[model samples]
Target chain A: MRTTHVGSYPKIPDLPAPGRWRTAAEKLQRGEITREEFRRVEDEVTREAIADQVGAGLDMVTDGQIRWEDPQTYFARRMDGFSIDGLQRWFDTNVYYRQPVAQGRVAWREPVTVEDYRFARSHSPRPVRPVVTGPYTLARLSQNRYYPRFSDFVLDVAQALNRELRALDAESPPLIQVDEPAILQHKEDLALFREAAAALLEGVRAPVALYTYFGDARGVVRVFYELPVEVVGLDFVAGVRNWEVLESEGFPQDRRLGFGVVDARNTRLETVDEVLRALDRVSRFVPLDRVDLGPTAGLEFLPRRAAKAKLVRIAEVKRAALEVTR
Target chain B: MNGLPLFPTTTVGSFPKPPYLLEARRKRLRGQIEPEQLRQLEEQATREWIQRQEELGLDVFVDGEMYRGDMVAYFADEMEGFAIAGLVRSYGNRYYPKPVVVGPVGRRRPITVEWFRFAQSLTGKPVKGMLTGPYTIAEWSFNEYYPTRRELVLELARAIHEEAVDLERAGARFIQIDEPAIHTRPDEDFDLAREAMEIVTDGLSAYTITHVCYGDVPRIYPRMLDLPVHQIDLALKNEDFALLEVFRQHRFTKDIGLGVIDAHSHRVETAEEVLDGIRRSLEVFEPRQVYVSPDCGLKTRTIDETVGKLAAMVEGARRAREELGAG
Candidate 1:
């Protein structure tokens, strides 16, 4: 079995005086540093985030999404027909993200995350996966002023992100992951999400991961089979019902599984024995070879040290799973 | 409560700490200063804020929470069964020491009563006794000891209830229990939040207010009215009073701490803009039910911005009262 992270890793490392990145951000805001200077600081931390994931023995890694301000505004600020507004709490967490307001017809101006994806690919020793916030989540979380119908807004965002995906596809990344954690909360919009997902994955040749977190995907798990994606990722920690659903109704055999076993939100460490037991149970339904061990969600909810440690635990679990399969 | 005028103005709770107080807090962390020295500075800062609010012509006052850090962490540091964890990111470029519940949580002493008494002594106006709600304290913290979320939340509610009773005894007429995390899991945990609130304000004599901000307000509305409190304080200005649309559908039964100023913006709102927000709120709520305030706490802003925003809020409320011929 292989291992990978959901998406973000902490930008700041665990250090006694790791105030350089924060100071640089403050300076950029205060007009004390150039935009290029701020980019240099972001690049430095991005390299550190990549190194941490690589050192933890992951099969594939991301840029750690260190450059992202938050999941929504990072892409929203770069796209056309959108403006950043006041802060809103992101789901149930203590963390907040700046709300995005769609002012006009949402369209792709240029490649938003392609440069960051290329940067991660060039810096990492392992193959890097490009992660993007899914269209359904973008539409749900944002304030839509232009589109009278929510489906139009969601599809517009999907088509816009499809252009970005095609740009990243040119880079020939290992895989593309689209996070739609918001779908877990609004299950009635499954048909809308399916349409948006098809639009998002249209021309991309790379294998795509449709991942959901922050809650159970039990309501929308059946629809995952119908979506045009290679892997279906579900959170098993906060959304423990996903496991119950997996037992009652097995996942599709044609699709690979992103086995999210580690608790990403909490700092608690999982033992190898405990993970092996969960892996053993999951192996009954899906083949262990078709699974990728990962955290329940992005590791950004944790501190740098705990996030790194969780990555290491995943690697350890993967090694034990391989031995058990052997 | 009957002595207050219509459109009475107040703040959510905290104000920005002065530069000197911030430095003193840092020094105290590093053991360069004693607890007593830090307490003296905190008292001074609290007094300065009290005087500033009085000068700003606000009808009610807050202690400014000058002695506190993260709302959850401050209480966790004093309560039993909690251990402070390392820094976790709360949002963009902001981090806090998240509390980890290691055992059964309970309060040994009355937290915030001493500060409430001290701030009340300085102000003739009723100083609000600010306490983070039990649901928020449990929600924001990492729980390891409790078998279930409800157990931890209820235990926290009992502990916070004790503090609320102490504040009422300490001559605080307004007790603001902030449950900013209330709407986080509105579908599953909202009823639990209401249940925990019932334990908190069961028989409290003070005019209780619960401040919930910056989430899906539309989902929790009408249902949020069921929360057992005298007032439901909300951050409405940042959302541009979009929540008023929900209130139009269901009549707001309780007094509303109407947020008329955007607390997050660096550009101070014009008095006209704040007056418009108050006017919008008054459309749905009675003039007496409307208590003018900022969207949330002013701690995230600079001192200048905080003062500017609150000043505009007061001016706008004064205009609103005049428009109603209640001044």
Candidate 2:
């Protein structure tokens, strides 16, 4: 029952300033470098990033999503139709990533690599919140070049993820976080989101978490509360105005609040006082344990050094949270 | 001529670039398609459009944005601190790039100079040099890096003015700088915009036109008229006419491009109604000083509707011409 960022950090190679993660992955896959060598590199990157979060005094830690790409199919080996394609534009900016798409039906390209899910669990020592791209967001992002309705496709995606989450739950992961960033953009389609949320966590045995970032809930958090989710996440940065809407419209008491106060898009590091103030105000409505202090979105939008700095700040806020709790 | 009636019309930009032609432009960019073949495709559309305009006897001939790839997308290649990652699928799966303003922007060289020169060459009638204004570019960008949005706009203004002077050198008598995003910011930026306008039209010749529409004109109109542009094309089709009094108050020295045609709706405005809109303009502008053109670029519109609307606009002007002579 906690919060985290969308999982997957591009593992940096030991060599001074590697070209891209793919080139490093290729060297390993081609047998030019041993798997142990690749693991060491990823291990260094993740351990340093996780320690930064822990040092920042963050209550929860994500492996900085260092080794995941798109994350929808990182671990699921069996699915109806899905695979990685040639590099395409992610939001049509200067940066490019190899895009994942649904080839036929919504299914997994591979099994959930339980390594990061397990590694994060082991790495945090403190409670680690497992973050995955939500089924609905994945369905909406991937083209319907094959799948018909995104709702139907997301249902299949959610179903496949259930197996992964259940396996993580059996391994005793504390929380599973679903990254539904696309919901803010598709505010008008609330029913589809509710249905999609219900579908993804359908059989997940773990305490389920869902995070929405980058925009306002359109004051539509009311519709979201109706989902069978235990904790609902929102980006307080953009959704500041929507809080009033949440106050006016009632929320389900069964759900916890994952309040996103840190801004992931910008490089500015937040202080302990600012994080404490947000935690205090958000805690007034939800119980102290029900709220997690974290950034509004993923650190992927920032450069590696800045991203690490922000996570360090997250840990600081978590310490502030403990002080408030005591 | 000063006492004679004035006419103005407009169309939204981004005329339908068929996939074949779009691919051809991409090919040209990649060095696959020859400049001649690309010219042939654009020229094919341009020549036909001008012929239709002349046949209809429209006063100014717009080349219908035949050569430019996308209104905002074209800037991605020219500017720094930004990169075209991928397209934004909005308004029903129409993809446009999310122009991430990852840093500050600067110009590389002239973007629209060659095509505008080519367009001007095809028609004997006066040609309209089309440019997307800096404010629009700034508004459309993510602009997260800038300390203030105004700085980014001013930076864009410098870049826009660079191309505008080039277009003027390329034989552009009428440069229509599009500023549909001007009003989106707060009211305080208007003065800054006025200063930027002076910079954009700084070395330009006569007949600098600023195309603006779909916002409160009373606040924007007077501030805009104070700029260096010779004519202001205002959206009158879906706006209040009371603001025309602001121009009447200034004894407006610059001409007005009164958008008598409704570009938003598909229903073609009747020639009589468009003429009626012109009669209303007579109250503000002296006849010769008034010009007729679309409210904006015809880019999003279908080719047939553009021609039909332009033909209707001309027919309305013919009516205005006949009525003014009689009056």
Residue lDDT tens for model 1, B44-133:
999999999989999899999999998999999999999876778777777788888999999989989999999999978988999999
Measured against the true two-chain complex, the DockQ scores of the candidates, in the order shown, are: 0.59, 0.04
Q: Can you tell me the CAPRI class of model 2?
A: incorrect
Error of 2 at B161 (Å): 1.3
Q: Which segments of candidate 2 are over 4 A away from where they belong? A: A1-326, B1-5, B8-14, B18-36, B216-221, B239-254, B283-289
Q: Which stretches of candidate 1 lie over 4 Å from their true place?
A: none
Supply every candidate's count of residue pairs whose N, Cα or C atoms clash at under 3 angstroms: 0, 52
Residue pairs that clash (backbone atoms under 3 angstroms), model 1: none
Report how far off residue B99 is in candidate 2 (Å): 1.9
Docking class of 1: medium
Tens-digit lDDT string for candidate 2 (B1-327): 322334533343445555567788878968998999998988887766667667776656577777766666677567777765333322211335446566878778787777777767877777777788887777655555787767888888898888888888888777878776666542657777777777888877747788776554666656666867877777776543565777777776777777776665676777887788788888877887767766656666666776777777877877887887842
lDDT measured at residue A193 in model 1 versus the true structure, 0 to 100: 92
Please report the TM-score between candidate 1 and the true structure: 0.96
lDDT of the structure predicted as candidate 2: 0.67
C-alpha lDDT score of every prediction, in listed order: 0.89, 0.67
Per-model TM values vs. the true structure: 0.96, 0.54
**TM-score, B chain alone, candidates in order:** 0.98, 0.85
